[model samples]
Target: MTTSDIDESVRAELDRLRSSIDNIDAAVVHMLAERFKCTQQVGHLKAQHHLPPADPAREARQIARLRQLAESAKLDPAFAEKLLNFIIAEVIRHHEQIADQPGERP
Candidate 1:
């Protein structure tokens, strides 16, 4: 049913729930930023050590770990895997860029 067709009490509850969702979204963004910052450092380290930008074994292990965590959290494992895959792809890209810049600091 549409919010406009709902009563005041229901509308108020919906508003409250939406506000909580918004706050969670903000927190997620900040957490991601923190994660990326760490990943950037990892990229720099890998670059300096002449490591490959992508680590298939580590990526597989991480995906499995995240999927298990998602299952425990009652979230969709496939969805969580997709999200991590996206993030991993971006991280690999960043790492490749860092590797290309031989002497640049992150």
Candidate 2:
């Protein structure tokens, strides 16, 4: 169990896997940044048009779509839905703050 006891090959394999995981984590963060940029634009557009911050119908559709995609990807659908819901909540919060500002024009 200890690092000192593990075989050299096993240590190398663990290092390789950890490196790949680190790379994947970085990519996920970058992708999330891009996603938020798009959602920021959406928030501005909604704020400009006097629209509601949260769209339940669209959210439902998105959850369903993501669930299907999760199934296709062999990921847990419930976990994907939960993650999307959390992201949607954050996006809605951002939209609400954008809507509150009166002077900024989108």
Candidate 3:
């Protein structure tokens, strides 16, 4: 193939790859939104029961589980752990806010 033809082919492939990445990004955002909704309900329940916002044991278990899943998926376990940690921190922040509302014990 000519140099110009090769360049066009490369651009086409890159565009296709980027489109797929954009779709995957959208899906990830939607899934995270759903997860946060569920966690919000959990936060409300924890607040009602006067439970602590952060659960070390559960967090440990989740990290382990996600690491295993990342291994199975052939993704980087450290990246998975970091992502989960960020999400967990956000969730705990929401839970703490719930726990601070009026009539909450702590």
On lDDT, the leading prediction is 2
Candidate 2: residue pairs that collide: none
Per-residue CA lDDT of model 3 for 1-106, tens digit only, reads 6656678779899889999999999999999999999999898889989888999999999999999999999999999999999999999999999888887654
Tens-place lDDT digits, model 2, residues 11-53: 9999999999999999999999999999999999998888999
Query: How are the candidates ranked when ordered by lDDT, highest leading?
Result: 2, 1, 3
Q: What is the TM-score of each candidate against the true structure?
A: 0.92, 0.95, 0.88
Global lDDT of each candidate = 0.94, 0.95, 0.94
* Model 1 lDDT tens row, 42-72: 9899987878899999999999999999999
| Ranked candidates (TM-score, high to low) | 2, 1, 3
Backbone clash pairs for candidate 1 read none
Candidate 2 global lDDT: 0.95
The total number of steric clashes, by the backbone 3 Å criterion, in model 1 comes to 0
Best by TM-score: 2
Candidate 2 similarity to native, TM-score: 0.95
Q: In model 3, what are the clashing residue pairs, if there are any?
A: none
Q: Model 2, residue 42: displacement in angstroms?
A: 0.3
lDDT of 3 at 15: 88
